[model samples]
Each structure stands twice: as C-alpha cells, then as structure tokens.
Target: MNVEFINPFLVSLVNVISTMATMDLKPGKPQLKNHDIAKGDVSGLIGMVGPKTKGSLSITFEAPLILEIMHKMLGEKPSSINEEITDLVGEITNMVTGGAKNLLSDKGYDFDMATPVVVSGKNHTISHKSKGKKILMPFSHEHGMAFIEICFEDI
Candidate 1:
C-alpha cells in the first residue's frame, strides 16, 4: 500500500469515533503486521472495490473497549458481546468506511464499500482474501485500545 493512502482512514476513524461515541482516541504510529489473521476479541470487517485498487479493512477491538464503546453508544452497560453490540460495531465500521471513502475519492481513489461483517469471540482472528500488506494502526482511548488494519492493493 502506498503510504499516502493511509491518511483518509486515520482522519476518518478519529473523527467518526469521537463524534459518535463522544470519546477521545489517539493513534499510534502504524506498523507492518506480518500476518494474515488479525487478533482481537471483536472485529468488524468491510470489503472495498475501486477502479485502481481492491482490498479490505478491519477494525478490531479488545473486549474491554468493545464493552466501553457499546455502553457509551447505547447508554447502558453491556455484559457481553450481544447482537446489539455486534450491530453497533458494524455501523461504526460502516461510518468509518464511508468517511474514508469520501476523503479518498477526493484524492482519486473512488471505491464502494461492502456492508460490514462483525465477528466476536475470545481471541478470534479475521482473515482477508487479498494477500496484501496489513498496516496495523493502534488507537488508544481512556477506556482501552483497538486496532485498525488496512490492506490495500493497487491493480
């Protein structure tokens, strides 16, 4: 992935998360994760297709952060990862993707995003079809931490 392709997602993630959940998040420097399977308790994945590239992106949250976010969004404590929480994550993924898509299109990377797919379990893994580099960006909030992985391939 070109390093310039990362800025949209980074800006979108921080802006949307702060707006929707009313929480502040800071991103750490992105690093190459030399693995296919992404590790986390809850993961939301979305596929992307564009004229010049095709790939997928995922936002994975640890258990504690997932719960914290859900509670903030739903205005109640979530005991576990239930359907509502899963849907919330999916919507969040969609929101981030949409914002990134808008920004990227301005930079000439027009893409359509697929509906989000959410998976949750104890240390589950998210696998993508594309064999692209996984640029992992970790985000931290007062509640906990999560990771956003961008896998992009230029055609």
Candidate 2:
C-alpha cells in the first residue's frame, strides 16, 4: 500500500470515529505487525480488494476496553464477551473500512470490501503482501484503549 493512499484513511477513520464516539484518539507510529508489536487477540477484520491492491482493516482491544466500550455504547454493564459486543466490534471495523473505501474510490481506485470477520484470542497477526507498506494505527480514549490496523499491497 502506498503510504499516501493508506494514511489518509487511517487518519480519517480515526477522526470520524473519535468524533462520533466523543473520544480523543491519536495515531501512534504504524508498523508492520510482527511478534514484537502485537499483544492480545485481534477482535475484528474487514478485507479490501482494489484494482491495484488487496488488504484488510482490523481492530483490536484489550478486554477492559471492550467491556467499557460495550457498557458505554449499550447503556449496560457487560460482564462477559457476548455476541452483541463482538458484533459491534465487527460493525465498527466495517465502518472504518467503508470510510477507507470511499476515500480510495474518490482517488480513482475502485475497490470492493468484504464482510468483516471477528476473532478472539491472545495472539494472531494480520499479514499482507510485503510489497507495499504495512500500517498499524493505535488509538486510545482517555478511558479506553483500542487500536486499528490497516494493511495493503499495491498491485
């Protein structure tokens, strides 16, 4: 992925989501995910395929952040990971991907996005073609910790 093509979406998506959710988020240095940078399970993923590239957008969070986000978004305390919260994470990932898709499309890159897939665990890495650039944008609310990773390859 060209950094120029990818960075705008990363910044824009974080900006849109933070504004809508009323949270302040900053873009931490993005790097390719390797054994060193990743922590817990990856929560949600959405794949993108364009004329010149293919990649995926993923969202990950610590358990506490997930719980707190669920509570705040749903107006109830969540004691455990349920379908609802997992679904929300997936939807959020999809929304972010959509934002990227729209931006890329406007730049004359036509692409289609796949349905988001959500996963749970403590370890797994999102890998893409080593041809372009890999980006991992970390975000945190004053009260919640979350990150979104976007990986793309230019064909």
Mark the 10 consecutive residues where model 1 has the least summed lDDT: 31-40
Q: Candidate 2 lDDT, tens digit per residue, 38-147?
A: 45454787878877777776787766667766666557767766787788778777777777677767778777999988887656555544555556767666655576
Let me know the TM-score candidate 2 reaches against the reference structure. 0.81
Error of 2 at 102 (Å): 0.9
Instruction: Predict model 1's lDDT versus the native.
Output: 0.83
In Å, residue 36's CA in model 2 sits off its true spot by 5.1
lDDT of 1 by residue, 1-155 (tens): 66667878888888877887787789988888876545778889999988878899999988888788777776887788888888888988999889889887887788889889998888987665577787888898877778899887778
Which 10 consecutive residues of model 2 have the lowest summed lDDT?
33-42
Candidate 2: which stretches are off by over 4 Å? 32-36, 123-125, 129-131
lDDT of each: 0.83, 0.68
